[model samples]
Target: MNHTDHLLIFEPEMAGHQPLYIRLLYHYLLENKPTLKVTFVVHPDINKRLVKEDGIKLQTVGNKINLVFLNETEISASLHNTLWIRAVNRWRLMKKYLKTTGANHGHFLYFDHIQFPLALRLPFLPEKKISGLLFQPPMLDFYGDEKNLKEVIRNYRKKWFYTLMLNNTALSFVYTLNPLFPSYARKHFTNGNKAYHLPDPSMFPTGDINLSDEDCALTKHVGENRKLFLLFGALTKRKGIFEVMEALKHLEPEYISQIAVVFAGKLEAGIRSTFLDKVDFYKQNNPNANLHVEDRFLSTNEIISLLQYCDIVLAPYHRYFVGSSGVLLWAVGAKKPVLTSNYGLLGYQVQKYHLGISIDTTKPKLIADAFRRYLNNPDDYERNTSGMERLHAESLPENFARIFFSKFL
Candidate 1:
């Protein structure tokens, strides 16, 4: 096991989330195993908006890790073949390095959020030996609306190409993004090992933002009369915000008035106006439905403050919600109970840690019933949070690295 020669290959430009995991793992390697080489082939998307200390920044972390921000678009134009821009750059970048260093053998570790798409061109990359960390396989059906022949052909290509990569690739280790991923991936990678679960460490506080005043203010908004239900993260269609609204409406006006629904995160395109419009409608008739909506990206402290002050954390993701959730981990760390989808990893964690309710978010009746039941007896779920104490200990960065390395078998 020549750990020094290993390459950590990933595109740290998908969102604020992708780069965060890389930074966390970089620190882990920096402190414990300084010999390992870490290379970040970030896309320009990162350079534009997400440069906050919380986002991925190209600062000097360690001598071993190389931060290579190549012109990914350059490779796209260069390749006449139908290969995607990311894969083309990944191949070109590695080929350039291999040519320069004259190194024959090195392990490639792929831990990208979009793992399956990389398979579209992995065979073209130079590395002979490869491994991957799949928190969740890309749900192809949920990818887009156009299920035409072109999309179907692309889907078949992904499967065929991925099968080739898996047979040649040394190991394909699966992790629970949600409970569905392990089984979901195993159906494809029969030889792959289900890895020990690893939590996202960025969920831990940076200790930079003091949320004492913020938490006090938020709690004061809820007052002595209301239970706060919080939906945190970048608002998206898959997050089931509309379904949650439907469920809330199913409750009697009295129950609705007693609860405060706070949507705290950057709203997706076109969702802000609709969300606010619905919120206004709800507020006009049911003044008791104390709605506190923050239509912007949440800072780290804001996330912490939401978890600290809220009575319940809302997940309610769709079938597209495979693998683990960074948002859920924050709520768990705060020891706040959650009301999430019972389908996959959310259900597992909710059961494992006694976090809170996990019901089918798509079924309005079920969502409403869960909300009603939870509202009727909040302490029943609150009492279950004692299980999370062990999870906090288990998910430390050092512990994650130890477990990650132990998956070598």
Candidate 2:
């Protein structure tokens, strides 16, 4: 192996949702196969931050990895103007970058969903060896309580463009987190020659964080004897934060006293009002109860510490379209018992692996009862921990490296 073949990872923005997985993938590739040159093709806005803060650099990792910061002229032209227009312009810019890069480099792997506007615009470029890796299907619809016609139409349009782009790919790999997504992708794309099913990378544990005793100390003052049920993710309605708060209201006072709920994540702008309203209502109704909400992002060490102390992890997600979540992966990595809803692939994994208890998001009592069951039965909690440990051991970095190399590398 000459170690000169390059992998080009294209992501518009390197913040929120996808970056975590991308970071994991970057490290996995570098550590597992040191010879291959990995070049991250990010938009100008993302490149600086990803390099400085996110630590996505070749030399930093003590390897000869390359990070190419391709300036997106089209995105810069339409940003702060209109999203639809911006997407169109971004597609043009991305196509230009791909064409120039592809001509210079003989072979490259694109680590993005098949539907990015740029992928659709790829017809303009000369044919070259390009592999498309799908983390999530672009056309998958997210169903929730919000029923605005305009929003619905916007989502459908976005999906339509994605479908077109994915169908035209040279080589494609669908990383299905849920069974439903793969079937949906296969049917919609209908490109058997290019597509294959790949599992979500989140299932593979990266590594264990070395947390000091002081670092693991609870954010809120914990009395000598107390139990805590923690929920950590973006505090949005779709994430079931409101439902969790409602469930807490019905719990008995004694149980409430023994329990504390810690919410750690940034709240989405649209749902900030709803989130605050629920928090206010909960506090007004139960003055003595402990409800700790950390509204900012936490460092990896902080997150690991919080996970270590959690009695039970709560992931009462309302949407079924999303296949896997980094939050759930973290809980599994930390060996904490999770109380997640029967949503999509995550629910399937929970049931199949016996990782934790699953509840219906519609029923608040189910969530409360599930929490109580784990709180009351120490043996059940222990059993769940054992299962999580086994799962973790089987799906760590080394195991994931083997799978990736065997299939793709």
Candidate 3:
């Protein structure tokens, strides 16, 4: 009967920010809307991680909350590895589950994955209300000054894709993490289905800063006198870790000795050995280099503790990563300075908010120069404190959940 009273949330991803994002919505629904029944369809990995990793007691949340794990066979690639194909397959699975569960409303917790198919105008079930959160939308203009032919063509294609997705009658709302997206959506793509900007939530650390044994070892390796520069969360070449390393070579021995670098997250699969080898070679060649690596999954508390323990947060992502960054928010929440990329939304926020140094991170020399500036006199950049509090306030989880859910639900 009253299908609108029930909400079905489908999230096939468990890595990165997926678990936290789903938990935020679940808790918000539980506490804010007591009568709303929820059914969470997630990857089997979520079952293993929900309670143990995130400390969420599903049984205690309420009787109205239900957990359903996705069938791997249903959403699996089955040989096709393309993103749109996988997105379409996931869409099919969600539609099937929506019908089976008899819920008229569904929400995609990680909507970016489904966007490819939606952009291509895939068949969405008629009359079913759907909402999704978008993290990396290509429609946003990331390259303003340095636009080549390929970049221009890509932006136009993605803008067209946004138009197609926004015009879908079944889609109720599209929420983006970038604050600039809503105005862009209004000016460019006019549709009854609203596209709104949602603040990327920041979970500030609480209680005592207790470092894990591995983290303690990292702290010991870096020592106490040197300024710690942290590159956190899913360490990969794309995150500009190697560029930061190469930038080290340009610094003098005294500068290197005064600063320490830590890569404190699981390295992307297959790149661990190569990264470690480079670290080893750099250490061997420059004994003054204080580089430490923790190539493993870090706990949430450990990550926050590391954030508090460090002097500066490093988010030197390449220009290709134009979306908002959780690391940037965490650094702001922790009131630490950052050396980030001057490319897209992330760069704009850093520059606008005086969060830290935003440079062209693709160049090692630029990164080194930023490091030098920070090393020279960190207090000189205390002017970066102006907008940190405002950004942190806007990024609270309650604000994120409220704005997103209030849109259509």
Candidate 4:
């Protein structure tokens, strides 16, 4: 009930995929009817960068949430190290913090499965509750495609270790954004000490923003006359970047000329060369088909601007488990129709609500056809966007917080 009730959130990385959801959770807890105290145990790399003078600001939405950043060492010594070493290192760092904190009767929220082994090892304060928040699996099935046989074997071994770590957690809370992984999670947490299917926080919005004079000018400059199709988030192999590129290849040159694909976020090393090569080929072959790639990290406002101006959003993940996506949520908040792959729970939700079209990413023809349909039936796309907005309004962070707190706290 008190703000000092102590909720520790352990995460390996806070910047990219994790922070948005964590921020939503932080605000929700703070804004709850009976406020719950929360402390975020962030990775050292994230904390160092975020706590800097020009770092991310931690402000509660309604003065209901309080954020304390506890820094932990990175999972790897170097950026391009093996994931196994990183997982082990992250667990060690988190374990060190948990042992020193000495908090009693509070809650421990593990954001990733890699933190679970260390969390379970901690000597918790008597009556303390431990809850695991699983965003996705430790290793994705498609990741193996990007590696050699030996490397794939090594990855799977590490994945097995991570799976065991997850099994040892007190309660596993899966954020089901993709519908495909629920059964996998259910099977993993079969004993069921505590396991709940919580929707991803992307389903909720912070609130509407009124454009200022300068903001209007910038929006008009960046987006005016541009039929934007946004693919926000890290450009990686599993993200289905190649699939989207292939889809674009199938589009008629004239039809493609009318649209622009805007990609925002950092590029992953695994597929960087291949992705860039494809992008280069497309640019050379089709000068009229505009492909705007922002190689740098984007701030929140810039992302919001893209969401606002974009006619359609693309979430073409090739192989993914059902979990929430910040991009999808942002599109919903911005009232933009999404064209996503029918691979996970996100696709299920989109189809269920008629909020967007789900295509088979494996088939370039289907992906191109989906886009053609959207272009031809602009009214249908608008209707889908409106439906997404309504769905988002119904699943506000406050409402979702109630569900999370009721189940965990």
Error of 1 at 55 (Å): 9.4
How high is the CA lDDT of each candidate model? 0.60, 0.59, 0.77, 0.59
- Name the candidate that leads on TM-score: 3
- Report the C-alpha lDDT of model 1 over 214-246, residue by residue, as the tens digit: 444545557567788988787877888888877
The sequence of per-residue lDDT tens digits that candidate 3 reaches over residues 1-409 is 1246667888776557767777787788777866667788877766466575556744424556778877668536411367677778777877887888877788887776666777667777786878888887765456334766876787787777777787777677878897777777777787723777888999775346655675455566667689999998878777998898889989988899898898988797667888898899999999888898988766666777677778999999987777889989889988998888888887788878888878889899999988888889886454356599888888998887777666544
Is 3 or 4 the stronger prediction by lDDT? 3
Decide which is better by TM-score, 1 or 2: 1
Instruction: Work out the TM-score per prediction.
Output: 0.75, 0.74, 0.90, 0.74
- lDDT for model 1: 0.60
Any runs in candidate 3 off by more than 4 Å, and if so which?
Answer: 1-3, 50-54, 57-63, 78-80, 139-145, 206-217, 380-383
> How much RMSD separates candidate 3 from the native structure?
2.8
Error of 1 at 181 (Å): 6.3
Displacement of the residue 407 alpha carbon in candidate 2, Å: 6.5
> Candidate 3, residue 315: CA error in Å?
0.3
Model 3 clashing residue pairs (backbone): none
Best by lDDT: 3
The positional error of residue 215 in candidate 4, measured at the CA in angstroms, is: 4.9
Cα RMSD of all models vs. native, in order, equals 6.1, 5.6, 2.8, 6.0
Model 1, residue 224: C-alpha shift (Å): 4.8
